[model samples]
Target: MFDTIDFQALRRIGLSQALVAQMFNLQTEPADRLMRVTEVQRDRLRLHDGEAEHVAQVWPTLRIALQMQGESLVVGDWVAARRDDSLGDVCWAAARVPPVNHLVRRDSSGLRQVLVSNVDTALLVMGCGQDFNLRRLDRYLALVRLAGVAPVVVLSKADLLMDGGASRAEAVRRHLSGQVDVVALNGQEAASAQALSPWLAEGQTLVLLGSSGAGKSTLTNTLTGLAAQATGGVRGGDEHGRHTTTTRSMHRCASGACIIDTPGLRGLQVDADEAQLDAVFDDISSLAPMCRFRDCHHEDEPGCAVRSRVPAGRLLSYHKLQREAQRHEMTVLDRQRQAAEWKARGRFAKAVSRAKRG
Candidate 1:
C-alpha cells in the first residue's frame, strides 16, 4: 500500500527518506500499509497514509505486546497496518514505527503517558491573561527539553493584554533570557500565526500544550487556516476556559507542517531527570561549576554563583523543579523496592506453608 505514495506527498505528513527506509525494512506482511497516526481514541485510531485516511485498530495480540513494551499509539506515530482479510473495510495496526523523539509525563498514579511522538517542536501555549503561569510554563519547558524537542513559548490572547501584550512578552522573554523562543500573538489573527511560520516548515511536526483557557484551539485554527479544532471562551469572572479539545488530533497545514492539538492538561507533572532540568535552565547549570561544593544545592552555600547571580524567584523555581524531578525519581525507586519486598514475603509464606504440609 505504501508503494503508491510519492515522496512529496509523504513529506507533507512528516515522512523523511530515513523514515521511509526504516518502514521498508520492517518485517511486516506485504499487504500491510504504512500510515501515520493522526488521532487515537479509546478503541480506534485515525491514520493517514499520505494518499487517504483510514480508521484502524490494534489486534488483541498486538495490543498486548504494545502494553508490554510500554509503548502507545499517540498523534504523530507511524505504524504498519494490514487490511483485514475477512473484513474488507477493517484495518489492524500490526506494528509501530520507532519514534525519533517523544514527549511524555507522569500521571498522579506515577504511570507514564505519551503526549506526542516524532515531533520536532513543542508550542508551549499560555494565555496573556489570568491563564498565564510562569511556574507551569517552566514545567512544560522542562518536559519538552527532556524529550529533546525545540520548545517555543507561545503567548496567546495577545488582543486581551495591555500594550498588545508587548510588555508581558518582554518580561517572559527576559525571564527566559534567550534560552527559548517566545512569541506573543492573538490566536485569532492570521498575522499572529505568521509569526510561528518559521517552525511550521514542511516535514516538521509541532504539538500544542497548555491549560484549558490558554487559546490553543484558537491558535491551531489560525495556523491551519481552518477551524479544525473547537474553541471556547473563558469564564466571565476568573477567565478559566472550559476544555475545548477533549482528544489529541493532528492536522496538515497549507505550509505542509503537521500540527497536533492536545487537550488542555489540568495536572501536568514533568517526568524528567536532573540533566533535563539543567538543559531547561542552562544559565543556572552553567554557574554550578563555580559553586564551592561539588554537590551544592546552592542554598546559602558560599560562592554559589547560581544563588548569587540568578534572580531569587527564578532560582527558587529552578530549585523547585529540580526537587520535583528528584522526588519523582525517588518515588519510582521506592515503588520498585516495595514490590520486591512483597515478592519476598510471598515466597517466605509459600515456604512456610510447604514445611507445614511436609
Candidate 2:
C-alpha cells in the first residue's frame, strides 16, 4: 500500500536511518535504499516498504549503536537497515538519520521519553460536555509548544451540544486566543471528518490528545473510514470516557498523512522548559518587556503593563495563563534538580569504586 508514498513527506516527518532502510525494502542493501519508520514496538518496528509494509526486529548491533549515540528512536522516524546472516533473515538494522523534531517528555524516572518524532501538527481534542477544561488545554498547549509543532484545538462530540444553548465552541473560544483555530464537529459525521482533511495531507504526522472518551478513537475511525480502533462509552453518571485506547498506534490516512492516537491522559505532569511556558503565555511575555522594572511580578509593580490591562479585562486571560505557566516552570526546575542530584550520587559511587579497586 505504500508503493506510492511521497518521499518528500517521509523526509519531512524525520524517519531515522535504520527504519528508513526497512521502509524502502533495502534491508538487503542498506547502503542503496532509504526507508521511513511508521511505528515501533518494544523490540520490533513496522516500516513502510516504499509501497507496502513490513516488520523488522532491532538487531543487537543497531541497539548498541543507538545507545552509543545516546539517541533513542521513536515512531515517525526514518532509518536504514541491512540483512543479518546470523538472524537467518534481513533482521539487522541501524538508525542512520536523526530527527528534525521530536515530542519529548520526562518520565517518572526523570529520563526523557520521545513520544513521537517528526510530527507536523498536534490536535488538542476536548469533548464539549463535562470534559472541557481550560486549564487542561493550557497544559496541552505548553507541552506541544515545547516540541515546536503547530497546534489545533479540536472540540469533539459537538453533537452533544445541540441543545441550542451557549455552544461548547463559544466556551472554548472564550479561553483560547483568536490566533488558534478551533474546530467543532461530531466525529460520527462524514462532513465533520472532511473538515480535518486539509491537515491530513500526505506525509504529515498529527497526534490526537484529550481525556478518555473525548472521541479520539471515534475521530480516528472517521478519518480512516474504518473501525480500526475500539471505542467505549462515557460513564453514565460522570460523563467521563473509559480507557478504550490502551496503546499508542499510528495509522496512515487515505490522504497519506500519519495520525497517532494515544490513550487518554489522566494526569499531565508539567515537564516542559521555560521557553514552552513562555510560548503558552505569550501575552504575558510581551507585557513583561514593557514593565518598568525587569523583575516586575505584575501584582503591585508601579509600571506593570500586565496589571494595567487586567482591570479592563484585556489581560485577565493572560494573567490566568501566566500563573499556570509559572507553576509548570517551577515543576520542571524541581524535576531537573532532582535528576541532577541523582546523577551526582551515581558519579560519587563510581569514584569510590575506582578508589577501592586501586
Residue 99, candidate 1: Cα error in Å is 0.7
Global lDDT of each candidate: 0.83, 0.69
Residue 94 in candidate 2, Cα distance off native in Å: 1.7
Q: Where is model 2 poorest over a 10-residue stretch in terms of lDDT?
A: 24-33
**Clashing residue pairs for model 1:** none
The number of residue pairs in model 2 that clash at the backbone is 21
Against the hidden reference, what TM-scores do the models get?
A: 0.88, 0.75
Q: Candidate 1's residue-wise lDDT over 110-195, tens digit each?
A: 67998889898999999888988887887888888889889999988788866888877887877777678888998888896579
Give the distance in Å from residue 311's predicted Cα in candidate 1 to where it truly belongs: 2.8
Hey, what RMSD does candidate 2 come out at?
10.3
**How much is 103 displaced in model 2, in angstroms?**
0.7
Q: Which runs in model 2 stand beyond 4 Å of their true positions?
A: 1-32, 68-71, 84-90, 163-166, 300-303, 307-358
For model 2 the TM-score comes to 0.75
